[model samples]
Target chain A: MSKGPFKLERAGLLQLLQALKTQGYLTLGPTVREGAIVYDELHRLEDLPIGYTDHQEGGSYRLEQRGDGAMFGYNVGPHSWKRFMHPPILRLFRARQANGDLEFESEGEAAPKYAFIGVRACELQAIRVQDRVFLGGPYQDPHYKARREQVFIVAVNCTQAGHTCFCASVESGPRAQTGFDLALTEVVDGEHSYFVGEVGSEAGARLLDRVAHRAAQEAEWNQALALVDRAARQMRHLDTQGLKERLYQSLEHPRWQVVANRCLSCGNCTQVCPTCFCTSVEDHTDLAGQVAERTRRWDSCFTADFSYLHGGSVRVSTLARYRQWLTHKLASWQDQFGLLGCVGCGRCITWCPVGIDLTEEVAAMNDVQTGRFAPKEAGGAHV
Target chain B: MVSLPSPIVVDPMRPRPFRVARVMRETADVVTLELEAQTGPPLRFQPGQFTMLYVFGVGEVPISISGDPQKPERLVHTIRKVGAVTEALCNLRKGAVVGVRGPFGSHWPLEQARGHDVVMVAGGIGLPPLRPAIYHLLHHRQDYGRVYLLYGARTPRDLLFPEELKRWQYTLSHAPGATPVRVTVDRAEGDWDGAVGLVTSLIAPLTIDPSRTTALMVGPEVMMRFTIAELRKRGIPEENLYLSMERNMKCAVGFCGHCQLGPHFVCRDGPVLAFPQVRDWMTRKEV
Candidate 1:
């Protein structure tokens, strides 16, 4: 276990990633797909977002061309690493009646060892947040832990920031500072002509040792730092200080109602959010009526059926539902989970049908409360 | 860890081992069961709290505790043949075994209600949850001010605890320190002597000290709306007014989102709530 900060030639990056894929592990990385850079299954280095850089801002996203063709060129993606690890839907247990007796078997078999590639700093923070919920909560979610324990993390320092991105505001972005087995900063066409890689764990060091990497010099580290700073500068910033209090204090504030108007309540925001883990369980007997399985599927509070009661839905209006969803995400989550819900992934704003930006909503709420945008005469100190 | 008074609010073993001590047909569709704990100790649950009555092979349904919580060892439950689980529960024999989970949910604040006027209102089988509170008030007659009961039934025959009500009314009217009982029926016949109107009408002449007294209510949502409204007219704040709620509760544990009410887990946070605290979310459909 040598203390190592290794370097990899830009051209050899593809061969190293391709080799890792052949060993029965799903090599997941940022790839250009569905008009967005998203994390998904990758088999070869060709799937990497090579020669591509991303532009991100509130309520917008675009891809740009880069002069240097680097394998890790994009910032964070719409799809996160959780999709491969903590899948939205999972079968918790299967029950079958054999000889008139109930047999319940927990479904933890065949959990795969996924080599998650190109995880971003914000995305890494999201993973840790989920770890608190799945592993550090009252009951250990066996499914999540099983998949998480068998996985490998490869983080790529962001070189680009997407529109609708605000990881900078939440203080969890633009650089893979820690929480990854192997952290890489793309430095194509430079003197090193390679990735400035830092290993954070024994597994990361072992993997790096398998690849042909040279000792990174002081100039390599300086170049790597410049790239991270450039990405951070591109990020859309929000004043997140006192954000939790500001959001909760204004539950009845007009901004929530305003945001609700644009919200379609289609639940795409939660679906794409890396940290949202609310789920609904369904128990159904199979065709033979001899076996039954309880399957948990990703559920969003925005769903009308999510809060359905005997007589009707709790949040009958889309406005009420949206308010509840956002407030819970940014404000009350701190009260319940002891942490801010948003990890600044920007997926919610990007995936929103109307592109409702939370950073904008917070700013509006603050203005509305402080009389910043009032008619000047219609204002007194708000309670 | 001040010894979380009740460590397991929703015990894994629901519908605790209660053997049917007696079963009687209350109506063509409903039955009342006198249950005796088959194992260990009886449950000391609060009024308004419920249990997941489990019929081993069938399933589980949330049923209110109709029996005395004080004499928990010998429990009682009433069920209407509505859903599969309820039908299974109604079909149990006097000797059949059943599992129970709970005494879950917040109960009427009995200690807080002491030394204050107490008003209880019930509709249909909602009587079961209210019965415990009614019984508790009667047992401790001198603890509070006026103790009035306003009850409503869908029809004369749908009335539960008919014999018990008569005894309860007599106890209140004759017990040197008791309060009067007000009763009503939605549809009445056969020379019924009680008021024939919605239960809300009974609260018009009723005495309620909103700031000081506590009002406990249970019924269909519509009935509760009107009943609680009457209490408000009588100047009772939502906090002092409480109600018991029922929904499709799959797991008595807080893990399931089926019984969630906003930020609260109805299974854990409350089946009973301070009206003001829940009034906003209560009207919000599923909550």
Candidate 2:
């Protein structure tokens, strides 16, 4: 419970996990599952992906054994903290017909108190973005607020950068700047692999007191700092200055059509994105017209029905859907939420079936505007 | 720091139970349901604002408040049988319970259009949504300049409130500085004596002063587009013209993204918006 950074060894990681469990938290952390590191319920330290590191780029992700026994080395995966906070689907309420009269009841399941472990800096930013969407607005989502209120974040500072990572460029990652109860910097140097625990809240400081840890040595802090710097250097760059206005101006940009040709409109990019929060609600009824349930499920803009109107679908073409997604992410999001929708976690880039790198696409648009990219000469199409 | 007008603690998604007081058949496919809230004070809403009408064990759909805004006790909704929920709602009998959430979205700026030459245009089922506005204007007859209502339907059979329209025409004829109500049909079938052409054609006979005139239109997108074009040809400022837009809405609040039109959430920002606000987006083939 000291006022400074503490050093927790590889063995001490177990005590931290045990403490979260003892505190009645539904602890969740990264685990190797289905050939990818995904967030799941954590019961033991063995659930952590020890000695595993992930290699990620556009349309690719591979987990490699580092042999260094680093517990948190992966950058990110398809799964995000939204899977816990916003949820893919939630029942808003239940309506039942009783005595020929209908009664509406908010019988949704009680929100679970989650202690999210191994949350990355970019993911922390993503959580903040979702908070704005679901909780910050005037009409707060009661369901999202109930789940988000009791969350205790265990944020991890990145020591390695995935090929698709651009969090450093977005000024959102490489280190947990804020929005975490407890922050950790995993340092794997030479024979030692440990974490520098920085308590961000009184609750985190109290929890640290129960863990087997000592004050972080000057050498250990320096290593953690060096690790973050290395990751930042390795991260890709994205020029986001004036991106909002630039995207708004490029509504008729030809590059949109080119990208549309490659985009499957499969909506995988939206599904994997940590910040995409659009959802659709449906009413389901049991046979004999007895009970009705209103359910809201995650919906993607890529789908034609997302913007369907009485006459027809508003965004009938893939071009319009792609335009809506990218424009909202980089441009109109600022207008809607006062923040860019993207957190540069690279999930969309890594999971795209056609390897459509958003960072590259953005850069290409800028290049076309700046006369650096010749659309006709490069792809046999005119700009 | 743009926030919603009010932060309601009660779940806006949940609807208050309402019972169908009376159901009047407007047309073969359309029914006008008089809904009375089962409990609590009556639901108050502005003209052109809509409510998410939920049929138990069926679904929910956004139907405009077609009744008088002044009378909040009993809500009147004119619903056409289009989809599953609407079909179920159309079949609902008196005493049937329905879930009502809203009146959500921006209302017709009737207050702003006061003292201006008001021209209201509606096509077919679009007439019901504009009925409330017409009622408001009629109630405050001295508050505006010349008022004209141009209504068009597919056929005479499709026309809504024929007796009501005749009554209004009679009342306006007897009133001082009386308003004019015009009726038209796309194709006049058997004994129909109304003008036969597009609804936009009705705009030509009316003396609309572009500088001080305000037009409110509601209908299919194609009809609205042509109406806007006719309004524009008449030299109406885009800001003075308003249109009520319809999109597939799940949650009548901003939370459900189904009602989004470009950057605007039709449920929140508007089901009614000024022509200028949607000018560029309206012409774009697919938004």
Candidate 3:
């Protein structure tokens, strides 16, 4: 509980997980699965992706050995914290018909308290972005709010930046700033391996008290800070100055059509996006017509059905769908939520099949805006 | 600093049961149904707000409230047989039960247009969504300066609430208020004597004070755009004009992100929005 940057040994992390478990929280952290690092249930410290790092680029991701045996060596993977918070599939309610009258029942299962271990800085910002989306709106999503309120975040400072990462560009990452219970900066200095932990909340202090820790030395604290600073410097740059206005004014920009040509409209980017919260509902009924349930699932704007009306889909072309997704992310999101939608985790870039980088797209749009580049004729392609 | 779970007072996604009290066929493809809540209180809504109507086995659709705002006892929805959900809704018999999650989105600026000249333009099936607003204006007729109802449909057969439209025209004609009901059709047939033109044609002929007029419209996006242009040419400010927008909706209460028109979620910030607020968004194609 002292105002000290506490130092915890490698074994201290195992005890920290045990403390969270004793506090009745389901510990979830990164693990190697299906040739990629994904967040899943973590029962032991070994479940952490130790000595493993991810090589992420546009349309590509591969796990690599860090060799230093650092616990939190990688940047984000395809999976975001939203997978656990706002699940891909959830049953909203169920109804049964009795004597020609319908009786509705809410699926009232209690939301589980989650101790999210190894949460990256950008993912923390992503969680905050979703907080405004599901809870800050006029109508709070009961399911989302329930789960989010009980979440105990353990944010990890990124000591290494992936090729796709631009959290520094968006000013959301490389170092955990706020909105976490405990912020950890992993220091793998030569033969010494430990974590410099900063308690962000009373709960964090209490949890740290239960673990083996000591006041971090000035040299150790500086080493951890330097590592995070080095990671920040390695990030790709995205000029956000007038970005909203640029995207809005460039609605007819030929670059959209150019991008749409290569864009598959497969919605891989949306799935990996931490802040994309669009969803659709499905209704199912029993064969006997006695019961019916409505299930909500994550939906992508890339799909034609996402904009369907009585006559037809509003956004018919892949050009329009792609335009909708990007515009909503960079421009309209500010108007809607008073915050930029993209956290610059670069999941959209890493997971896009055609390797479309948004930073590069914005740069192209900037060139057009400045009249420095005149796009060649797109042959009657409409944006 | 451990926070306890908040009590779940209500789940917005859950729909309340409503029984079909009466089904009045308006056209071959459209029908108006009166719904009464089976257990709870009636769904009270403003003139322009809409409800998410759910057919048991089928899907749900966002349908505007067609009943009078003053009379909240019997909820009415004028539905056209378009998709599978609306098809099920249109074919519902009396005593049949359906789920309704409602009274969402912004309403017509009735309070702002109280003393101003009210100009209402409706095209095709859009008339039903505007009926509740017309009722409000008529119920409090003395509060407004001038009231105009300009309606257009594909044909005379396609016009909704034929009997009620006639009654409204007759009653407003004899009253002290300056109320006029102008009807038009795209292509008149079978002894149809109405003006043969688009709804925009009706706006040009109306004598409205530009400063005092508050134009409200509900229809196809193209129709609304044209009507807005006509109204603008008449010197009405963009902010004074209102329109009811339609979009694909899942959660009627802004949880599902389907009903977004630019930054505004049609279910929350709109469904009814001032023209100036959505001018840029409306002009953008496939936004």
Candidate 4:
């Protein structure tokens, strides 16, 4: 492998996939499935969403033809790499009763080594945020730690930004900075298509050596950087100046009630989000009551039962539930993990059925805070 | 290839089994169960820490340890039948087995409160969690100044450990370094002769040095809030006051995200927290 930035032609991309598979990694990448691009098992280059780019906005997503034959042309979709890392459902342990005595056994499935082919910069930061939640504490989550440690990241720098894309505003994306094994910038000029590859780890350099590649010229590297910069300029902005402090002070700011009026409480935003990581457990028993198993599944704060105690749910009204989710993501997460929960991926904005864009909501709150908009009468009853 | 750290072998979710040795009914809806481990050593826990008690076919709930900390051989828990899990736990008889994953969260800062007058305020079922701390103070009676226990319940019949309360109020009050006990009720009944009002009413008559007093309280959120206000008016600094909090907890190790009170996980960061640390949060509703 060359020392600096190297160039790989369209055919070399297939060779890179082959090299990763030969090294005993399960290659996962983007593919068109059910009219949406999602991450699935990839065995060949044709398995990618070639010549397809996504058009995204609040409450809408569509796949369109790029016509330029670019393989990695799309922004992020509804699925994230967390589906493979943390998993949506997991069996925690099992217990069996015999002779009035119970025996317990842990579900000890071995973690798999995965080569993630198309990780975005914001998604990478989301993975880091989850790492802090699961591994940074004194008691580590064994299930999360095992899979997270074995992941091989292959990050892709964005050349085209979707309408809802705001990673540039959060300082988390458009260009892959760190937390990746290998970073790629796809360069398509008229009839020529190639990837500008930069090795980030020893493993990435070893894989690059197996694929045929040449040192990139000065002009080619400059063109790659210019494309990412253009993508950065195309993104929408989210003003985060003192946002955490502002949200904490605005717990009863009435904007929550306004949003709750439109929100159906369907929880689609949490399902599509890359950084929301709350879970609840359920216990199951057999018909004879001999065997019992406990399973953990992803849980959303939108549900009233999420905060249920002995008597009843704490946040009974939709207004309180929405306030908890938003404040926890924007304000309280900083106090808990020392970092913002959102990476500005915009998946939540695009997938929300009512098109409740968080960036717009924050701007509205700022309008009231700065006295740009008149405050409504404080008569809205909250449970 | 990058080398990663090996996974920790101990799983925090697994619960050990314990057999019920004796069950004593404290009230019509509350019971105290003494448990002995089915296997392994006994559970050693500090005062104010809680355990995740699990019924075989039912579910699990967080219950604070109510026994003496020094007497770890017999694990004791006082439970009120509030939900399905607690109902099943209260019905448990001798020789019945249950699961327990335990001894989690912050404890009362008794060590830091040394040499200061200790005042404990408990309401309803909250006294069980504070009972262990009272036992600790009595065992090490020489380490503290004046000790007082102010307790209240819904009614006289609802009071727990009736015989023990009598001994502490009558016998111990005459002993050196005595722990004076004051009892109150929300409403009076037939043949009742005691103060009848909210527990905060009992705080006015206590002769305590606010500067040197350490107040520990446990009760419902509204009760704690009012008690905190009364304690503050008495000139007790916020840092010297402690309160035990309650929230819906699934994972006691802080992974479930169900027990979050603002940024703090009540299962891990507390069951007991300083008044100043949660002063701003307690004022907000449904946080």
Q: In every candidate, how many clashes are there?
A: 19, 0, 0, 0
Q: Per-residue lDDT tens digits of candidate 1, residues A190-250?
A: 2234788888888777667667878888888888989888878876767877776666456
The Cα error of candidate 1 at residue A72, in Å, is 2.5
Where does model 3 exceed 4 Å of error? A190-192, A370-383, B1-9, B173-179
Clashing pairs in 4: none
- Across residues A258-359, which tens digit of lDDT does each residue of candidate 4 receive? 999999888888888888888898888999998888898988888888899878887778888888888788888998898888898999899998888999
Q: Which residues of candidate 4, in runs, are more than 4 Å off?
A: A190-192, A370-383, B1-9, B170-179
Q: Write the per-residue lDDT of candidate 2 for residues B33-94, one digit (tens) a residue.
A: 99998988899999999999998867789999999989889999999998888999999999
| Residue A219 CA displacement from its true place in model 3, Å | 1.7
DockQ agreement of candidate 2 with the native complex: 0.38
Better of 1 and 2 by TM-score: 2
Model 3 backbone overlap count = 0
lDDT of 3 by residue, B84-103 (tens): 99999999999999999878
Q: Is candidate 1 or candidate 4 better by DockQ?
A: 4
* Tens-place lDDT digits, model 4, residues B131-170: 9998998888778877788898999999999899987774
Report per-candidate DockQ.
0.14, 0.38, 0.47, 0.40
DockQ, model 1, C-alpha based: 0.14
Candidate 1 vs candidate 3: which has greater lDDT? Answer: 3
Error of 3 at B79 (Å): 0.4
